[model samples]
Target: MPIAPAYDWVAHHAMVSPDRSAWADIDSTGDGAGLACNWREADERVGRSAAMLRDDFGVGRGDRVVMFSMNRVEFIEVQFACARLGAVFVPVNWRLTVHELDYIVSDAAATVLCADPEFGDTAAELTQRTNVPHLVVFSGAGSHPEGSVDYDDALAAAANRIDADPALLPVMPELTHDDPLTIMYTSGTTGRPKGAIITHGMSFWNSINLAELSDLGRSMVNFCFLPLFHTGGLNCYTNPAAYFGGSTLIMRTFDPGEALDLINDPERGITHFLGVPANYLFMGQHEKFATTDFSGVVTTAIGGAPSALPLLQMWEKVGCPLIQAFGMTETSPMVTSISKEMAVRKAGSAGLPGMNTAIRIVGEDGNDVAPGEIGELWCKGPNITPGYWNNPEATADAITNGWLHTGDAAQMDEDGYMYIVDRWKDMYISGGENVYPSEVESALFDLAGIADVAVIGLPDEKWGEVGQAVIVKSPDAAGSVLDETAILNFCRERLARFKVPQSVRFIDELPRNATGKILKRELRG
Candidate 1:
């Protein structure tokens, strides 16, 4: 017997636990009201949405549907609907400008566009510019734009039209694990973002990897506030929890104070939590930070980048351990993660590789490096992506001999713990010596009065290139604001003289993409 598509799990869940909570969506518009849906409702809702995509929009197998929305029930429904029909769902970063979105939609040859009304101007402009045949608009009270279909109306109509109809009973196509599920566009820190093809198997394997490592179960209640366009938000804990019959609280936008309040609520019994390093930092700085009860949180995971030791120490006060993970959009977003059991001991490390994942740190010769030596990280696993969409050259460069070149410079210790030094492109040569900015930044992360910092190489007349430290100071820091001298002294104590930043520049905050990873390229400018 063949395995059914992942979407069929929703129906299975509905049959087993029809009234069990599936997801609770928090309003993003600053209002506190929420909408809760059970497994049965979710199954029917996705089925209706799928019917609309098939009957109304003419979406079929292998078609591409682009979604431009924040984290909402509609976004989840659309993704399932697309999967039901064997169509690929392309989730674009709503934070992206119209120009960036245009390239992805056009490149994917999307047949239909589904967007939230919050991005009305962008959606209207995109439809006019691209070959997208149908536009479905969702969210808010008033009618949808002039020519677009209102999301609520569309699903309700489809439900009413197809209710109790035997012909429309099997709206979903026969799909296998190898079928493409989504086209997640990378955050293009270097250039134009490429759409990474995510298969059903990759997603399923990642869920399995996480469930085994994190001990996720039906009793687990996770929270999601990250943007859905990235794998960190979609595949990380959200989909994994949903896949394992757990409940998830989805927030449309992240608010540090609001998140603190939610976590502190005793009734929610929020067990599993995941956030980028910056999120933990912000929440640690919130006014309620001192009073928030974190005793209920089982596993607090951090990804997107290696976390600062100081941030981890802060969470330690709340009786929570911050688990650092390392991955990219290409690897279904999970290659290595610090397990809950080893989180404290391997505090700063990316921890061990996933159960089915193999990680290698290869030097310039494309051979595995000795322990403690930095090299490009290569991953081979069932969870790894097949390749990028419509870009064979990029795909060829990314995945070779069934191994996905992660493009991240990493070092592994004798105990098999991995450390992500920096991105290959982000590593720069200063004074004829290799300088990984993350190494420098990690040393500065524990400094007094310093909130955040990013190091970049600047062209130098004598050294070819030199390091520049961009700093963000803690708001309530006492004594005095740190200067170049203080920063230089701090790094001088912790890092090599050549590795120390040549100059220091202070800023209010670091610029980050939607997923909260520092945008070092923007800082370099």
Candidate 2:
């Protein structure tokens, strides 16, 4: 029989490649115990977990179960269990505040929440206000909160005997290509967050595209350090790696030194790595950076923020080309990427659209713009999301005529190479002249004493809005003053006079949302 389009990867892999290594987690703490699981073990655990969800917790088809934890072996197992049982998995960002977590749980209508002990306090505060009926704690050495179930104990309570027939579980409904599979909440850099409804087909298609685009075969082992709650980490890396029968070296949390150690480890056989630019920046500056060997890694995917040209050059100096990609949680997180070959030639451009994708630049009048003219980027593809979970007005506004309006202003060259200017909402008009923050941020990146910088428009009575550059000075440049004159002088040489920042403020760090994207909304405030 042919494999179903809505195939369960855990079930398929267990049947086909039972003995293959599926996932490995290194204990960063000095416990001397690491976690490893093969396809067979993963499938059994997921199945047993699913039975527990059904029999014990009363979780079944169409129910929402939220997983609040960092990267761990059980996270993947629980995700698979949810998938197999036709339940929706909502992975909450552990970094969110209690109020934020409460809002999401209430908004998503998640009935069950599986949390790690590390977040017990946050979960306790949220559960008090929300309607969450069940709480299961995993990987915690501490006592469980009252009315909460221990994850390991729950799993053990379920009979260890496998289901009589692997296919006997409830068949996933005849889902349209657009039916919701995962509801990933937006990072909410601008305002209140909304859940982006990712469909089963969207996730599966993007994973297939990524596997083919990156040439990820069975022998490849991918490194995942980005939070699994984010689309780039979950759909792009973990889900896809499982689809192709490849292995994933799961990092519970992102740490530059630990990541470098994992990359240099010969036993892990890590061939593919993906991370945000901040990770590369830290790793490149580490004391042992030069001596670390990355000859085994064939591809390094970097995104989530604009990488400095200097940082890319630094990685190149170490014999690795960081392929830049651009996508949001709404795009199934794989919209466009700079191919390995083009990474050298096009330093900052997020390369052409992937297979089966269409990209166009539209002006305020909703028509395509000419080459080199900045306009809002709109994308349409199988991978593009149908709409936000609820909020029809927002959905209608974001998706018009079947194209997902990206809200990012960009320009494309004659050869179809695209360059991101800035978010449409982020671009400010000063003195009747357009100012893209990315332009100023790029220039700031070249400055000697800058570690990080974000440009925002401050309320100005004269120019309507004046540019304010908020900077985080490098550790070496600490205790030194970075006055507005110095920044203005630096920009005067690189940018037009009107585009230069009118004011400069020294900050410890730019504010960022859960996904690590700079929160200009907070910065403006």
Candidate 3:
């Protein structure tokens, strides 16, 4: 396949629709608004920002430029800038501890570290330990070391040196679609964090894949509240809008009422967005949710986890249908998605594969399973990541014959829609019977008095392992009435004997990662 030459899509959109809005940064805390740049201005900002990175930071081709900042419009600027320079942009989770980030910075050997003002001290400390060559305060420059670059001053200087409207990487014409666009690190729950190399090809394919499934076009206004550090944030709708000439409403961070405010506002014209189950749960439970009119909103996707029936009904009542999607970081995070029409008709289903993507449910024997049988889900497409960065061994283990082993247990129904059961690794055998915790959790959701629940396999005296239920009781549940015996009996009536939990442990809350996925590893103790 012939690869397209190196370039940025922002430039093309700017030329085609110069005056159209490309990005709108909404603070959501105060007036609930910020910078709203049209295509022409956004393109100029990206060009000058790229120049600043190249000239001031000495950033170059193949170098890693790691950014540690909250959800701001500058993320788009820096990412596109890196692409313009033939460099790789790396966005780290702001919620991650300094020690956790140190591992990623050192692993990537990041040349230039850019961060928001609040994290300047953390960035400085990282620089000290990793001894990174350069550091730049991404947005506002606070009391940091003198050598650090301020994002605004650097861009102004770059504008003075470069053309008013500049051409990006005219000399590096050989840069192609397969070149590294970003190195997104996976949530290192199981082991060490592996940097998934997201290529320019995957970015384009994801946009095409999303467009194929939904009405994401020039007029699309994507409301982005998810963290840009994750694939769901960047590739989900943010990057797709950039590719299709649509504007993105970038929020500083997630705030339920604040989100409702923007979604309800007619002027913002927020059309499409993506969120996890927890996001919808909160938004639905919000006092303002009762009045949330889905008139301006077209499609808001759900991922990270499956949506419960009540959660699905909550949005359905308000006229917004939750399009449940399934994917991970390595696949550019888009594998399958259900349509709004099938939102409840096929509730809990991940729906169909994208036009450019293919999926297979392979059983333990490495053969395709019959329509309703659960098996490991494997994905292949232009959207799939090539492999992990600097970890060839890990890469080789992840991909086989151009197919990414998604490690997700799923099944395809007769209608061709896929149902993601649970993580393949999360499945445990009880007395030789496979037990998917998600299945148990879903069943438990139907039971009253249970606020939240997670099931894990524990060592057993006779059976190889037995299911253990870690639960959070609803505040209204009468005391002692919802004890271990009652819960076990409730499961016994619903689940197979082997699937029922042998023991129950109640907790105030369930531990979750940034994306709201229950931390099973943390629960194992």
- Tens-digit lDDT string for candidate 1 (294-366): 8888888888655667788888878888877887778887899887667767878998889989999999998
Identify the superior model by TM-score, candidate 2 or candidate 3: 3
For candidate 3, the per-residue lDDT at 51 reads: 82
lDDT of 3 by residue, 79-173 (tens): 98888789999998776666557778899999898887778888889888887888888554344566788777888888877754455322233
Candidate 1 Cα errors over 4 Å, as ranges: 1-7, 28-33, 141-143, 164-166, 188-190, 427-525
Best by lDDT: 3
- C-alpha positional error of residue 281 in candidate 3 after TM-score superposition, expressed in Å: 0.8
Specify the poorest-scoring 10-residue window by lDDT in model 2. 161-170
> Clashing residue pairs in candidate 2, if any?
none
- Count: clashes, candidate 2: 0
> Which of 1 and 3 is ahead in lDDT?
3
Q: Arrange candidates, best lDDT first.
A: 3, 1, 2
State each model's CA lDDT, in order. 0.81, 0.77, 0.82
For candidate 3, report its TM-score. Answer: 0.80
Off by over 4 Å in 3: 28-33, 141-143, 163-172, 427-525
